[model samples]
Target: MSLKGKVALVTGSSRGIGKVIALKLAEEGAKLVINYPVADEAESAQQVVEEIEDLGAEAIALQADVTAMEEVKGMVKEVKQEFDTIDILVNNAGITRDTLLLRMKEEDWDAVLDVNLKGAFNVTKAISRIMMKQRSGRIINISSVVGLMGNAGQSNYAASKAGLIGFTKSVAKELAPRGVTANAIAPGFIETAMTDQLSDKVVEQMLSVIPANSFGQPEDVADTALFLASEGAKYITGEVIRVDGGMTM
Candidate 1:
């Protein structure tokens, strides 16, 4: 888990699971680049950077809307200017708009796909070049259990995440020759702001189906990302590792 001298970039790291992933990597000695979507989130992003610095690691926050290619490129250019190389990339920016398939608006589906799937593509495409030149890097995409098992009223979200799995596998194969690896992490029922919005009955129902009988914390997913980025996982690639407490099993 030693990531000393590595420069890791995590998207949507202003808060939630992404923030935790950035912190976990920083704890292992990686210099961090935190990406948030907008100016409104600048404060939160700075806070994450400061926290990483507090851990005695270097960190900087950059703004970029993952759905936009130019912004993604600019963001990567800034990182290259400051760090010279990127050793890791975690695509953790995703959004969900739940609704029955019949009622799911086209905008919702497009929005989810734009951020969850295409965002991964935009950032990974830009960063893979750097990794290829360096001949080493790690890419971890944050997916969800729903992407694997399907969830009612969340067709859009499920589709985007499932697309990410396919993207990760293809990227893995494409980059393997250059010493870069790509993998997906499917998390389940994590107690985040998103899950907190679910009703008590919904939570209870989720717990009933989960073998752990309790929701996972963001750190659980963060630890999994840490493992995939570590030297121990050099042989692992193009795989979707579930951090879901046996929910899909």
Candidate 2:
């Protein structure tokens, strides 16, 4: 399960699940490029970079808005300058703009789609050229169960995540011949800053429905990401692996 000598780029890795993913990959001996949008806290991103370095894996943090193609291109360039080649890409940067369809603003819808779906597209597209040249790569997109089973007050978020699933399958087919694998992870109710904002009653009610009867930690998602990025998952692609504590079932 070691990724010795491999280089990975994890977007939105400043904190939460993304941060844990980067750390877990580093623990598995992968050099990392941590990407965070301008809106993310710099301290958190830097902390991740330092933590990876402390673990004896090389790591660098780069700021870039994933929704912007040019920014994503620049981010890839920076990563190339640092690691020369990227063997893995984790499209973990995403945002939720939760609102009922009737109340969802155009800006909210566009913003969520732009960052969650288009952002993955921008970063993956930029890195595909390098991966194609190398004839090997792994792409893991962070999707959500809400996308699979529609949730109330999250129309925009659901649409964005659902789009990722379609994009993952399409890209996997396109890159399969090149020895590249693309997949999506649909996580449900992971404990993070984002979920912390949920009302206490909402969280309680949600937990009651989960078979596990508990919320998932960031490491659970990170472990899944690490496996998908490993050699063990080479034969698996164009698929969505749920890390939902059986909630989706």
Candidate 3:
């Protein structure tokens, strides 16, 4: 899975699954661009960049709100200036506004979709323009198991992720001729700060459904992203690989 001389941009990579994915790519010899949203997250973003540097890979942290097209363009422009070209893009930034359909606020739905689905579109479109010229690139989107099998309190989240699956497939078809591959990774219950917010009862419910009897880790999803980004997956596109503990199956 050597990515020597490749340049990878992982959005929302300051922490959790995104951070781990960035590290995994760095370990594979890819120079990294860690993307976080807010100024307050600069410290953690720099920390991740330092960690990648420690691994003997070049890395820098950039901030951009994926929901905004201009900001996304600026981030990609900066990356092009620094790396010359992008070889890999991981759309790992997402947020949840969990609530039953009846109780879900309009803002919650919009926010989740903006960051999870529209954000991927914004970043992918911007990066694809660059990749089209390069004629070779990897786009790995981080989806979720709930998107496969709907959840009660996560209607908005599920919708956003389901949207990503469709978007991934479409991009794969559109970019494949140019040798740009796009795929989605749907993870079950990954042990991340996001999952930490679940109540004990909710956790128990999830565990009962998972055949693995244990939750997954961020590294698990990161490894999958690594595979999708590697040369080994050159022929794989428009596919969704699940990292859930057999929860959806």
Candidate maximizing lDDT: 3
Every model's TM-score: 0.99, 0.98, 0.99
lDDT of 3 by residue, 17-129 (tens): 99999999999999999999999999999999999999999999999999999999999999989999999999999998898899999999999999999999999999998
Ranked candidates (lDDT, high to low): 3, 1, 2
Residue pairs that clash (backbone atoms under 3 angstroms), model 3: none
Q: What is the C-alpha lDDT of each candidate?
A: 0.95, 0.93, 0.96
Residue pairs with backbone overlap in model 1 = none
Q: Which pairs clash (backbone N, Cα, C closer than 3 Å) in model 2?
A: none
Off by over 4 Å in 2: none
Model 2, 1-249: lDDT tens digits are 999999999999999999999999999999998888985477788889999999999999899999999988888888888889999999999888787899989999999999999999999999999999999999999999998998999989999999999999999999999999999999999999999889999999999999999999999999999999999999998999999999989
For candidate 1, lDDT tens digit of each residue in 132-210? 9989999999999999988999999999999899999999999999999999999999988878778899888899999
Cα deviation of 96, candidate 3, in Å: 0.5
Least accurate stretch of 10 residues (summed lDDT) in model 3?
Answer: 144-153
Model 3 residue runs over 4 Å out of place are none
